[model samples]
Target: MAGGMPDRNFLVNVFQLVDKDRSGAIDSRELQSALSNGNWMPFNPDTVRLMIGMFDKKGSGTITFEEFGALWKYVTDWQQCFRSFDRDNSGNISKEELKTALTTFGYRFSDKFYDVLMRRFDRSGKGVIYFDDFIQCCIVLHTLTPEFRQLDRDQTGTATFTYEQFLLVLAKILH
Candidate 1:
């Protein structure tokens, strides 16, 4: 509990409150209900599932108390990142803001890529990205970039793969 982080007791209380079913773990629905976006909306189910997948060390599709600390840190870190890039404080990230964030993170993508990203992640069809969607989008990019770099060994901005190889890559990442 250094550096103003919540103490272990506090984390345990929160975990207990969120684990409504008393199953000793927090599932996606429980996590989603417990979390709120910048706009005070419930977290997106997909984002919750993604986080669970990332931290569910037991492969139980749920986060136990032992894993809650890491999950909490992950969400708070993303919240800080979202606030920094959401310059307008509108509780949403515009395409331009997203581009700036990507650039700041050293992602050099084309305009078309940005367009496609916005379209795919704008679940509300509002032409802007809400907190949950923004998290999901960034997580996907963060997870895939290393794999892409590995495939593009020469760094020539391209990779050649057979259909089976491509499927394997996707399967590995998505799993």
Candidate 2:
């Protein structure tokens, strides 16, 4: 495969292995069980569901083999990204590491904002972001940045919105 992606046979084997129920697809639980946080911990269920929602083109709430290839690539790409930022190799991103990662991604946020992010994404309450939580955090930032920019017509890093407009924008993003 190009870009060092696993060959089709390897992917098929992995898909089959993760498809424990032999349902020809992998549900969130199956995916969660198959994934790890680089520390032998199961991936977060919420992240698994979010990923399934993204790749489940059929809207079946599961990932078919046909969809598995893309999902695999997505996870691997995120894995590389997380590892790159996890400089201490602790299998989790500390607040400082997260700050560095976000800054590198071109995000400009206040220390308070970073605190909020750490509190929100640090699911284990350990003041560190695990692999799945890190992915979720990055995805949120990545997805929202352009949407916010679209509203910030002057590029002043801020925008004004009516109550209705705010709801509409949030609705669009949530769906």
Candidate 3:
């Protein structure tokens, strides 16, 4: 379940990259759109398929909260992620703040998709979320995420992600 994202510090990089509005969390459609169309690059069907496979934990054709949590464990210790998203720094991200984060990423998407993305990521309904609790949300929007996974795929083969891999991925999206 460990998606094997980069180390803890890298988590912020992913956040900043997807935080198009500088808000913290990412919603599902934003993730989809981002994948379909990289912020600085173009979108690719192959990349999108690969991504859906990576985050689609429930196999219900959509990503669920628990699925997103599994990804959070990859780049950070949940406690730390939670602390940051706790907006008021109150140990939790409020629903408004959470929506803000998703909206920041999903503003380009349809109203309906955005709604589903937020509802799916903010499972507890506590109105707020911890960064650790929104892993899938973030990963779905990560430009470098697929390469990150490839690097960690020592299981199938020791295919470490190198600058070459980064270039290849960028080429596909950018071109």
Q: What is the lDDT of residue 145 in candidate 1?
A: 80
TM-scores for every candidate against the unseen true structure: 0.92, 0.89, 0.30
Assess candidate 3 and give its TM-score to the true structure.
Answer: 0.30
**Candidate 1 local lDDT, residue 55:** 96
Regions more than 4 Å wrong, model 1: 1-5, 172-175
- Tell me how candidate 2 scores on lDDT: 0.87
Q: How many pairs in model 2 have backbone atoms within 3 A of each other, for residues 3 or more apart or on separate chains, i.e. clashes?
A: 0
Tens digits of per-residue lDDT for model 1 on 1-175? 1134568998999999999999999999999999987666678887888899999999999999999988987888888889899999999999999999989988999999999999988887889999898899988888878877888999988987788877776675465
Clashing pairs in 3: 68-136, 93-128, 93-129, 94-127, 94-128, 95-127, 95-128
Ranking by TM-score: 1, 2, 3
User: How many Å off is the CA of 92 in candidate 2?
Assistant: 0.8
Model 2 misplacement above 4 A:
1-3, 39-41, 168-175
The Cα local distance difference test for each model comes to: 0.87, 0.87, 0.50
Per-residue lDDT tens digits of candidate 2, residues 19-93?
999999999999999998866667877778878888999999999998999999999988888889999998899
Q: Largest TM-score belongs to which candidate?
A: 1
Question: Which parts of model 3 are misplaced by more than 4 Å?
Answer: 1-85, 102-112, 143-175
